[model samples]
Target: MSPQTHINFTANPPKLHYKPHINLTTNPPQPLYKPTSTSVQTYINLTTNPPQCHYKPTSTSLQTHINFITNPHQPYYKPTSMSLQTNINLTTNPHQPYYKPTSTSPQTHINLTTNPSQPYYKPTSTSLQTHLNLTTNPH
Candidate 1:
């Protein structure tokens, strides 16, 4: 009897192609040690503890008021056109309804007269005084 012949067959393994997934809409992952921008830090700080940094301006600068007005996160009182006119009248005459007329009317009147050179070129006087008082006294 002839010895049986042995045969072995082998097939090549399948090849796999790998491709990384990318998200076009999202930004690339930030580096672990990357420095944050000042604006970003300010925004984070503002969001984290908003009440702590109320940012009440001590000066009567129009730019400051404008900043307060423009800041979307902060709570600001945007005076109406009529209210603005009332403010003008109060500053010019000091005897007008005084907007929020109260027992403190005389004090507001004095502040308006004293700081006639305030920015915005008109009477932001009542609002300014009220803002200052509210920030300083907070009661």
Candidate 2:
């Protein structure tokens, strides 16, 4: 094999990636297992509002307590009282999207993933050929 990406790409998806516009660097990382944000969101257009994947890592003073009530109907668990307390780490970094998303609207191109192993790819109005191509190379 040529060790080159053998796909003949036109001007749409751009030549440098399997996907598009993913800024690997200058992006902050998220915590390992942070709780999902409880913010209100609709099925907003990604061009306006990008999907939230990473959580704010600066959760220095979070003490969450969860209480579970005993249910007689469910046989899976029989607990009198169960409470969970979680103390997330104090290290914090502001949340970052998958890639540098368009602060401006009409995002003509978008990257579908941040998975490092996959060949970089993006969906663009210009590049219909490489739109949403998720491949698994089980090396």
Candidate 3:
């Protein structure tokens, strides 16, 4: 007779037999405790604009502000509020011969200086004559 061997095996893994109990009655799991008051306050503040902190003005910032106020050609310089008086002078003083003429005179000046030999000579001459007449008789 031939010899025979026998072996035994379990159908499921050991972990499946030891599953933890879950309480379906309760809502989703949450932290055991609340966050601190300061953390909560910081979260609230983050939702809005934070307060500006006080600090000494640096020399660079002061210089920039000064330059912005002083230099008329600077991009950040606000000429509207500061130079309104100058603009008024230009507009008002067009009637005065001592103050040159209106803003349009600059175009005539450019035409005379840059286009003296170009086809614009005739139109520029007519414009210059009109400007002279207007200046001589400001009414």
Candidate 4:
């Protein structure tokens, strides 16, 4: 019982179960092996089905219209000359009408468009007393 154990019990070698070599040769750059749509047992072989990949988003370059004033989480401010100036002086007797000190100029003027309904008084040329008490009667 020993001629190398009868040639290792009559030698039998041939078993490679995994046949897949498709080359229907019309040679246009073929070596494709694809199994990854985040692969988890995806072998799809209904005659190698692979022809569907689509992406389309466009209504003037991918549908986008955002102007929260150039949105930096929306809240941008710097606009004050009495909120972009809209002069309103509906003059009658909004507390004594006017004082014209455009000459004999002695100014300490901070009448940022004065409002008690347009009462801008900036005259200090050594007390040149100009007084107008328009006695309120504009009904």
User: Would you list the C-alpha lDDT of every candidate in the order shown?
Assistant: 0.19, 0.21, 0.18, 0.18
Which digits, one per residue and each the tens of the lDDT, describe model 1 over residues 1-139?
Answer: 1112121212123113312111111012222222111110000000111222332222111110111121121122232211111111111112321122122221122112212243232224222322212211222
- State residue 66's C-alpha deviation in candidate 4, in Å: 25
What order do candidates take by lDDT, descending?
Answer: 2, 1, 4, 3
Model 2 backbone overlap count: 12
Give the residue spans of candidate 4 off by over 4 A.
Answer: 1-73, 76-83, 93-139
TM-score of each: 0.12, 0.16, 0.11, 0.11
Off by over 4 Å in 1: 1-81, 85-106, 110-130, 134-139
For candidate 3, write residues 71-98 as lDDT tens digits: 1112221212111000011121234324
Which candidate tops TM-score? 2
The TM-score of candidate 4 is: 0.11
Query: In model 3, which regions exceed 4 Å deviation?
Result: 1-72, 80-133, 137-139
Q: What's the C-alpha lDDT at position 104 in model 2?
A: 21
In model 3, what is the error at residue 81, expressed in angstroms? 2.0
lDDT of each residue in 1-139, candidate 2, tens digit only: 1111112222322334322111111112222322221221111111212334452222111111221111121222211211111211122112323333322212212222323443332211221121111112223
The residue-by-residue lDDT of candidate 4 on 9-112, one tens digit each, is 11113223322111111112223312111111101111101221231111111111101111121122111221111111111243324321122111111211
Clashing pairs in 4: none
Q: Give the TM-score (vs. native) of candidate 1.
A: 0.12
